[model samples]
Target: MLALPAAPAAAGDIRATVRDRDGKPVADAVVVAVPSGGATGAGIPPGLAEEDQRNKEFVPYVLPVQAGTRVHFPNNDNIRHHVYSFSPAKTFELPLYSGTPTSPVLFEKPGVVILGCNIHDWMVGYIYVSESPHFAKTGADGKATLGGLPGGDYTLRVWHPRLEGSEQATARPLAVPATGAVDAATTIGLTPDFRARRAPTPGRGGY
Candidate 1:
């Protein structure tokens, strides 16, 4: 019988935990792991992303998508919504509509996109277009796991809506091990959230 070599170990997973300056778990934060020296493999495949409007607010509040992904803005409320974003990453608008738009918006650039409702000034949301494919959003527990990452040097960073400083300041170098998982934690300072307060009902338009 011929002997065969054992299969190489699978890529390791990265588990990240985020907290605020006050030591409180932070939710909806975007965590990204970028190759320290640029990525060599094929980029993640493009896919459909969504930001839904319900109860006069953008669901999920924060969204992370790979560059070149198309995002759909679906209205689930009884009233129509006018969605727009003036961010440098992607600028687009969807004039008053009550349901899914005829077409989706393409985010070809890598940057932060701030979303708002022209009909509901209090409604705000974000879409983070990441240049790297390795990214995940923290859930209510303030934890996110990115799996199957080949061992290598990487720059790990986190982003939140109220983050006080530049996202670059949060970048931390990490060396992922070949075999098990890496556990990482980050604490972020936050500025006072000055988003417009939501009224009991849609009172006026213009954010």
Candidate 2:
């Protein structure tokens, strides 16, 4: 009989906090830590085949998964929905459907994926599949810590939906020791009017 192997221990940790010019915490900011050497395939992530459905909207609004992971979209609403995205990470669509699709949508690369429903124009969602395992999304207080990072050189980057400039512009190199804390920070100017509005009622006449 064969025995399963033990899981690898976390080598290090990355404790990060993001704040604006006024020193106030910014919530829902995504922080990604990409390995400099471009060596992926470390360990298996916790979740896969995540569900993004039309409950009159995208469930998570923002999803972060490992590269090569599959995502599922099930139409939970009564009406059918056509989901598609123009993001470079992955570009595909599911024609109007009521139940779960037979095959899962796979994200082959590492980048942010923006989703929208063709039938319902107001539906919007994001999928961020990272190449590196060391990454985390900031909480309401703008604090995120990525533990279990192997000690090495890495390029850490920050991304937001409301960001105006390039994602590469906000990137900075990070060096994590075998066992210690490192502080990384950044401030980005966001678009002035950026907010999500409720979708219009289907078949509602124009004013």
Best by TM-score: 1
Task: State the C-alpha lDDT per candidate.
Answer: 0.88, 0.77
Model 2 vs. true fold: TM: 0.83
After superposition, candidate 2 runs with Cα above 4 Å error: 1-10, 45-47, 193-196, 204-207
lDDT for position 174 in model 2: 92
Residue pairs in clash, model 2 = none
The TM-scores, one per candidate, come to 0.91, 0.83
Error of 2 at 88 (Å): 2.7
Candidate 2, residues 1-207, lDDT tens digits: the string is 889898666477788887766787776678888778777535567356565675678877777788888888887777777888888889898887777898889987989999987777668888888887777888888788977777888888877777659878988899977677777877866666444576676684320
- Give the winner by lDDT: 1
Model 1: per-residue Cα lDDT over 1-207, one tens digit each: 989999976587789999998899999999999987777334468799999998889987998999989988999988888999989889998998888998999999999999998778899999999998888999988999977788888999999999989999999998878778999999999888899987755444322
